[model samples]
Target: MNVELRQVHDSDLPVFYRQMNDPESLRMAAFTPKEPADRDAFDAHWAKIRSSDAVVRTVLADGDVVGNAAVYGVPGEREVTYWVDRAYWGKGIATAALRALVTEVPERPLYARAASDNAGSLRVLEKCGFRTVATASGYANARGAEIEETVLLLEG
Candidate 1:
């Protein structure tokens, strides 16, 4: 599948919300659920991203939304996070999206975190030039348990 990263548009929220709330996607992402995300939440989320200087991109595969990837935080020091639809897992879309985000930002020392149990995510980070920097325990709402998170960093 051909994948490319582009700026997120308001029209993309429905697709974004669906992928984000998918059981498998949330499980891998370690997101803490408060309530079912509504259009308002999506609006606020996208608004924050749009108004911020951080680089946020949507991964489109064959004209369909496959994932969302972004670098956010203070300007020079940024954290990267991405979530791909469960159906698209293991298809190299995450790697491609990550590579594109990194290339676009070209900022030094990008940070990423993944649940230690998530080998696929860790592998993606490793493939994208991130080296494990630390590991810590945290609560994953998606997993509903305390889990170890491996922190990784990529330096320009």
Candidate 2:
């Protein structure tokens, strides 16, 4: 599959919001709850991403938005997060998007975390050069249970 990263635009907000609010997306992302209580928060969040040098890319496959990947937090030390549409799962979209994001940022010692039970996400992180360094017990509202979180890091 052909995969490319593009800056998210105002025109993409609706689709972006929809994908973000998807039940499956929330579950995979370990979101605390299913509530669209505030729009301003979402607005402010995207605004910062748009104005900052930090790279946030929308994954496109054959002209469709399949997922998103981003590097956030301070430079040199960054956190990576991504989620792909459940419908398109198992197609290497996350792997491709992550590889592209890493190339675009070139930041060292990036970090990522996934619920330990999320084998798919763990695999994606591992495939992209992140190594498990630690694990922590935490409440994952999306999973509706306390789970182990695996912390992974990629050093330049």
| Per-residue lDDT of candidate 2, residues 5-47 (tens digit) | 8988677776677776777667777843445435677677779
**Regions of model 1 farther than 4 Å from truth:** 36-39
Total colliding residue pairs, candidate 2: 0
Instruction: Judge candidate 2 at residue 60 and give its lDDT.
Output: 88
TM accuracy, model 2? 0.88
lDDT of candidates 1 onward, in order: 0.85, 0.82
Clashes of each: 0, 0
Compare the candidates by lDDT and give the number of the best one. Answer: 1
lDDT of 1 at 117: 86
Minimum summed lDDT over a 10-residue window in model 2 is located at 31-40
**Pairs in steric clash, model 2:** none
Top candidate when judged by TM-score against the true structure: 1
What is candidate 1's TM-score against the reference? 0.92
> Candidate 2, overall lDDT?
0.82
Whole-model lDDT, candidate 1?
A: 0.85
